[model samples]
Target: MTVRSDDTTLEITRVFDAPPARVFAAWLDLGQFQSWIGPEGIDCEVELLEPRVGGRYRLVMNTPERVIPVSGVFRSIEPCRRLVFTWGWEGDAIRQSLITLTFREIGGKTELTLRQEGLGSVESRDGHVRGWNSALNKLDHYLSGGARR
Candidate 1:
């Protein structure tokens, strides 16, 4: 996406204890999503949120010596089944990526799948894969009542 002409894709899968509706709600709610948007050590703060399609959302991830800004516009919202949004990391994700998240119910548990596309290079793709894995793992713990301190 960035200024580059090429595009890449990244995908990851994880399971959450909650139901699809609940998980979707967490994503839809600014406060809840902020509580679990980043890696274990990174703190997230919500700035602006509009969850419907064609809406905008913004958040900041604070870490050592840096504040990462993330902004997105929702492209699709399918209740408990799917969500599609454009993701930009203030200065980085600008490389161009549209992220899609799909939630499915399996035996009362929710399976979450993240698909990111339109990245321009391998480095950006790798960074997103790592970032998504960390975020999703943190979310898994959060949903399981980790009592994170």
Candidate 2:
């Protein structure tokens, strides 16, 4: 996996051994999503998940320091291909961002590209870089049939 960040945006690219459909399903399926969507050692709870466009979802991430609630609305969804969503913290609704995921099939594997924009600051973008990289590492392990934490 490779992660890159700029002033207000972050991009991550990862190759998974699973097929595109399986990899894409992991993002929308609550059971699958909760298994691999947060930084290492963080416990995640999916409060609500509505996978269709215009639908909303909420998640609570319990880190060692504190619990963070994140909510989002699905903007677009194309099965096994792409997904776009609006992301924001529950308390700070004004600081909303956009996340786009693209899935491409290569041989029998899948190439996943994640792009998050409008982070508002370099520090925030960097934080996401670390968080996302760690999350993707977990995703890789999960797809490899490793036990979920």
State the TM-score for model 2.
0.96
> What is the alpha-carbon lDDT of model 2 when measured against the actual structure?
0.92
The lDDT for every candidate, in the order shown, is: 0.81, 0.92
User: Candidate 1 on 21-125: residue-level lDDT in tens?
Assistant: 888887888767876887767888889999988999988888899998889899999999999999888877456579888899998989888888888788888
Instruction: Give per-residue CA lDDT, model 2, range 1-149, as digits (tens).
Output: 77777899999999999999999999999899888888898898889999999999999999889999999999999999999999898899767999999999999999999999999998889888898888899999999998886
Which one wins on TM-score?
2
Q: Return the TM-score for each candidate structure.
A: 0.88, 0.96
Off by over 4 Å in 1: 1-7, 91-94
What range of 10 consecutive residues in model 2 has the weakest lDDT sum?
86-95
Clashes (backbone N, CA, C under 3 Å), per candidate, total: 4, 0
Residue pairs clashing in model 1 are 1-95, 1-96, 2-95, 2-96
Clashing pairs in 2: none
